[model samples]
Target: MQLQTPHLTLVLISLLSLNCGSWAQSAFTIDSVKLTLLPGNSVESGTKVTLRCDVKVSHSFPQLSHTFTFMKYNTIIYSKNSSQAMVERSFTPARRSNSGSYQCRVTIHSKEKSSNTETLTVRGLQTPLLRVESNVVNEGEKVTATCSVPEETGPLQFSFYRNQQMFMILTSNENSTNTSVEFQESGESDLHCTYRHMEFPDSSNSSNIERVLIQPVTIIPSIKVQPGLEVVEGDRVRISCDVLGHSKNGYEVFLTDRETLLMSSPSSFTHSFEVNASSSGRYVCKVETGKTEKISTAELFVAELLSRPVLSMSPQQVFQGQMLTLSCRTLNINQERITKADVKFELYKDQHPLKEGHTFNFTASQSSNGNYTCRATAKNITKESKQLIINAKVPVSPPVIRAVGQVIVGKPFQLLCESELGTLPISYTLLRYQRPFYTLTVSGPQRSAVFNISYINHADEIHSFTCQAQGGAYSRFSQALNTPVIEPVSKPELSLGFPRGQTFTEGTDVSLYCSVQQGTVPVTFFWYRVGSSRPLFTSRSSVTRGEHVIRSITRDHRGKYYCGAYNDAGQTQNSEPVTVGVNLAGWKKAVIAVICILILVLIVAILVLFLKKARTPRKRKRAVELSVKPARPKSSDPMRMSLTLDIEDNTAVNNTPGVMGRNVWSDHVSDSESDDPGREEECEKLRYTEIQPQQPNNPEEVALVVEECVIVNSELQDGTQEDPDHQTTDSVEYVQLNHCNQNPE
Candidate 1:
């Protein structure tokens, strides 16, 4: 315990020294050290000013010594020991070099520290520095002015004052020290800027004055050429300039190639000029608006024009299936010189493009026979040559001559000539016996011709015919052919070989012959009815004779007949109508003859009977006729006599009375004498009564009557006949069955 006190004291002292060392390394500082210029922070050059430095430290230590040092822009000018911690100095006029940043230094215990920096700006009004972007700018270009005050706290508003008037205003951002303003420089203007603080609006200072001299701005015109940069020679080219945003009336546009002027116009934007060999070069367009000028340049090339093309054919006339060669040539002019390598050729057939080459070759045919032309082209120029016609004529073969109809006398015929596989527009001629008969030209490829012979006569038999074809420059002929024989037909005469006069009996043979005097052989005969148009019979004969025969004739064969003869040459007239008559059958004729003979016999018998009757006596005829006459009753009587025929009495005349007996009957014979007393007339009417002795006075007659009565009574007593009803009138008995004959003498 006794030894620990000294060791503790040593340890405490060592720790105090270590704490003081650490504090001395980091705690040494200069406080409240200031360097100021009397009156203000800023001043003009050559001004009287006072410079002062005040220094202070954070801790006062007995061992800590203080010294104050004043410096001007990092160069020490005064040093002093400031027991009072203050020092002062003075300068009558400050130099421009002394107007930079200044400082005050405080040193303690051999360690020195500096104060915050302070700046002093000593400015002189002698020609403030002015920077103009460009003295000669465009009229609308911006001209900026920057006014600065050194080392001043400011949110400055800067204004451009032109000729003492505010031309523009610009406000800087808060706490910003930038004092620049921009103004459009137009015409002549004296410009300057004044920058003032936000707190002191009226307290401001101007920068150096500047004169912004502006000239008229000329816009660069856009220029271009029409029809592109490549142009054909002798072609018109248009060069145009668009002078936009400029006055249109006062501008003059000039177009040129290199230094040579091509065209110039006032107040115009476009100009047209012909391009030639001399026009191919760099072209320039200059636009002058008042005193200002702008220009643009371009390069142009002018191609030469092509000359007319020439076409040539190796052979003018070519045959079919043969090679044909055609050549085309043209002159290509370039820069006033002709060159063939620059030109191209085109061949045309019938105005249509055939090929594109200098020479063309192909097998020729009929379709290739047309006009051919050539065309040449160089750059943009074209020219056509004269047309050349090609003839691909094919040789014509022998013509085929054909006869269309039969070659006979008095008949028309047609001969045709055809040439196939030949070229078009061929001419043909038909010759008879080497003489030209007809000539014709065919327009199309069908090469055919026809000739008509109006009438073929006997003379044609000795003639020969031929056909010829001509195409272009070639001709061909066919072999001769002999003409055909021709004979005419003559009228026919029809004859019938019959014993009867043109008449034939049924079931008999008959023949008709038709003969022509001057007709061809192998003639055909036609038999027709007289009124009919169709033929009833047809016969072919080797000679000029035609015959028709009928083995058995019939009624149908009886008609008017005519015959016609026709040969290959022509037809003859029909023969006259021959009336052919057909007789009836044999049995039919015999029956008609028997009937006629029987009629004659009957007529003769009738005549004989008439003669016998005529030869009889008239009295006997009257007695026979009166025997049948009836006795009519008198008018006062209503009774009539009736007679009945006795068929059994063959010996008596049993003939009934005729109409004449009835007409003159006894009833119609009236006794007119009884009705009229004027005259006495004997009544012819008689009645049947018994024949008595009429007059007793005549006894001889009575005696004869009695004798007759005795004979009658004796005949009656035989009883061969019965007595009729008898009547007794007055005192006499009458027999009604008997009549007295008027002629009973």
Candidate 2:
């Protein structure tokens, strides 16, 4: 027996252990199970997988052991220990090495029971990363698809879209990448690729929305259109719209007048409406799209045709060749309401046109006196303005020149110039030849020129005066003339005399005089001295003789002088001056006395010599008588003639009155012969009777001979007293007689 001694011990121990468990019970349960996956739940690779082993309850000291295990597809993947409230568990993502399912298993143990088993399911994950570089494809290009996996590299599929609609798909390897299908040209499409993963999810999304736009064969529609200004009547207007594209069909165009459509067409659109003044409204354009129900619109404004333009008048009436202007205006319109072509205008006189084209301007003249009109061409139309009438004025004529007096001096004469024909506002200018005299201004009432002056004193004055007239637009002037009038210079009075030419000895004063003959005004007088180039002194004229006196004359003052007088008019000629020479003291008187005395003394000496000569003649006569005594027996002495001699004058010798013939000499009667005239003759005869009648050889004998005698003493009748200054002069004249012995006895 191997140990028979323990049979009773083993049976007793087993019953005890079983008996204790009947009194104590166990408390435990399956807590929970949580599942996770890496590309394992319909997702991609490179993702984490989480496994949770959660317990709801646990008995203290009675819970012995807990076991948790993770599995994939009934295969163990991972596991962990758990007690009282269990936590979670995790697993890594699987590549090609982990393509399977996943689950969880729990084992529990307590004091009286054996361990228990609980099972949960798990799944593995698998993923593949794939990409395609180019999805859009032009024509005739090779297609390719590239797929990449961490465990194995392979091929993929690519597709394309046309106009956002799918079209084609393709598959390729890394050597030849995959892309969209090939065609003849490019177009708009979308492209994507397909990828398969053994470790993760089966497919993936695309890179981005791939768009490929193609050059299309279709056309595009037009844009909007508008107008700058309003539409006008009769305008060949372009009802235009803004459009773009090469498609030129299926378009409808029309022009509108507010709500009403004036013209419409599919082919020919805008109306070139030749409008009149009555045609005008709001305008616009309407169009339709090509082969579509769409509409394109453009609005425009057609303004009312510019009111018939009119040209007007200011002073419509004027003379021919007068200046004027005509103004043209567009009527019945607001400011700037129309465009350039809306308002048409032109000017005309009668039917003749002014400007070649449209404008609001015109010119007028004297010849422009007719019905005037304006031609207005607005839009595509024309009109003629209302007619305006004009009247004209004529001009006046020029007048003749006239005078009021014969003379135009001393404020008494007047002259007038007038005009019968000239324009209004005529102006006149009075002139003496080219020299201006006076001026006159006139409009209508005052149109005359008057000249007035008096007192014509000039004797031979002459002048030719003129007047001229001017008015509107008279480029030249009209003129006329009158007679002429010279004045002479006045005469001056004069006097010529000296104050006292001889007051004038050495140191006294002397003057020259000047007086006017008939003049009354006080006259200025001047005295001129000779030897001087200018006047030595000056004086003035008065009622009395004007004297110019100079004091204390020297020797140099002995020169000529003259006096002159002057008034307001001018000066008179000078009068001659008298000179007075000055000498030293008493010398002049002494010289005169001495000259007279010497002259008297010479006369006395001359008388004495006359007496001596008288005596010699007597002696000669006595001697002659004595010599003749012897010859005449009866010779008696009687009164005989005696001789007189004037020694001062030898020419007085023949001047005795009785010498030529015996007159008063007689013989004395008492002395016998003196009483008888015959006896006196006989005595004289006998006295001369001869002694020796020969030439006397001795002068003593000749001396005793008597010659001739002079008698000066005579008596006047009535016996007036004889002047003592007169005395008897006895002079003698003796000659040698020849042979006196024969003398008459």
Candidate 3:
């Protein structure tokens, strides 16, 4: 029963959940949306049309509002929010501008859907009427052309055509437009007009053609050239222009050679001119009356009278200080009219007149080089020959060769070859060891040529480079260029004065030698310690080897050592590092030895005196005791003390000035008098000696003496001994001996 109840509960809950899900999913959904064009997708202009938007939607709710939108060319034209799904707009008369892509969109809540785009095309335009003001017109006379579209308005572009070719276009807001055009020739032309709506470019139509007739001018001009149209240069020629028909309006006539007006007169029609080669062309005669003009043409040929003088030069190649001759020659001429003597000749250099003759002669110097031409004139006609260029060659002087910059072995460098005086183009050859290795031709005002030498194999070997320049028939050689090449310093070898595996002692002089296998002179040497960037010593030497000496070396000088060498070649080469160790100086060792001996001797003397006292101590009831007072607390103070021995009461007391009435063994006495029961009182047998304090000349000696005494006392206190008294006695004796040694005076 329990299981069945649980299953039934699950089933009921699932059913309810599914129902809620279905309602949520179907809250708002668009089933379909469509845009339709009424009266079909394509229709004639002025026909009634409609754009409709239809949408179908499904919703869970009983009532849901939706928006309907209609768009043309992606721009919304109509929109409405309503419960209904269908919406529409109508155009009473469709216009060409109403043709385009249309779309509809429907929105419900947040859900929206758009319909596929549909196109509407309204085609048809009114045909324009073409008209002309006159059916017949004279050539060059303007006639009016009118294009009208009575049914259409609003800025229209109208195009007018003549003989099927459009010649003019105009825009007007009126239904009719007109323009004036002229025909250049007398011929019948077919004229038409076409108009397009500015708002809807596709709305265009053409009108029927109109025919117009053109008439020729009444007065036609005739041109006649006297002496048949052909004549030699420098000959007189006359041209006449006359109207063929008589005119009461008194027409004017013009005579022209090509486009240049020679004569224009209403009473005179003849023109006389001396013809030259430049005057040969078509001659035109024109007549004008009222708005009409007529023209006739006649071609004239003017033969050259002296056949263009030709300028020539003797010995095509001219050199400085040599004679040069220039002559003018002519192939043909009208000898019957003009003789050789009748024709005058003149020469010009660089546009300046030089001489007048058939031939000219001058010395070819630097000043003579210029552009030359000759002129021949006869019968008021002049002709010039083609330009002749003259450049007198100057023999090349000795060329100079030099290095551009510092030369280094195994590197590319440039060498320049130049001449002080020479005319380009000059050929240059570079020689190495008297053998040509490179050649080049230089021109265009560059006086020098540069040659790049890739590399030199040997730095020490002598190499000579020379350059030769040739401008004319002969070549000249430059002086040889010789310069030493710089060599980079080789890796240096570092050596210490001490033998291998031997340590250097402090306060000894040591030398560090650095040498290179091969390098340039004036080499610079540097000494450095390992793990350091700066050099300890630096020296410049003319040889490859260098040395650095350290006087009175100290432990501070201990570390790794290395050397570096560099020359003009700019590279510093370093040697492998060598380790150096420094030991203590010999004088310090000797001082330590003397201190040990003094301590040993004092211990032996104390034992001997104790043995002597024990041998006779029982007979004499009093015991002798010696006590030494230590110096001041300063570690550097000399161990100066006074010692005295007492033979009564077995007690020793120091009577020194600063330590009077004080027991020298005060610490030991305090221990003996302590309350500890384990200790037993014994007879005092240790002895100490008193030595007087004395001032020393050297403070270092006093410090050494103090140090020795301190060492002896510490050793005695720390010694493992069966008898504490014996150790105490030894320390006292050591102090006494050290004081005595310092104050022997």
Which candidate number has the best TM-score? 3
Model 1 stretches with alpha carbons more than 4 Å out: 1-306, 314-317, 321-391, 404-413, 458-463, 480-489, 497-503, 515-525, 531-535, 538-547, 554-559, 565-572, 579-600, 617-745
Question: CA lDDT, every prediction?
Answer: 0.65, 0.47, 0.76
How many clashes show up in model 2? 81
Model 1, 323-392: lDDT tens per residue? 8899998644664544677677899999999999989999888778899999887655667899999988
lDDT per residue, candidate 2, 1-745, as tens digits? 5596599789988899887674333544444444444324443344454545444444445554566666656667566666544545554442323445555556665422111223222332223333434555443343343433443233444344444455655554431233434433446544444343323444444333444433332322332222233445544454443334535766666656667777666644334444444444445554544323223544445455566666766555445456556667766653354565556677776787766444433344456557778876643456677786754444445555666544433335666767776555666766665666777767767667676544444422223556676664442334545454211112322222333445345666654455555333456665666666676565554443466666766666775565565553343444445554455325655886787888888877787577658756643443333221112222343323422111222225423222222212222134443557776566555444332234445564344332322111112111113322111221112222332221121
TM for candidate 2 is 0.21
- Residue-level error in angstroms, candidate 1, position 435: 1.3
Sort by lDDT, best first: what order?
3, 1, 2
Better of 1 and 3 by lDDT: 3
Most lDDT-accurate candidate:
3
- Alpha carbon deviation, residue 530, candidate 2 (Å): 11
What's the true lDDT of residue 367 in model 1? 79
Q: Which 10 successive residues of model 3 have the least lDDT summed?
A: 654-663
- The global Cα lDDT (0 to 1) of model 3 is 0.76
lDDT of candidate 3 at residue 731, scale 0 to 100: 36
Evaluate residue 28 in candidate 1 and report its C-alpha lDDT on the 0 to 100 scale. 56
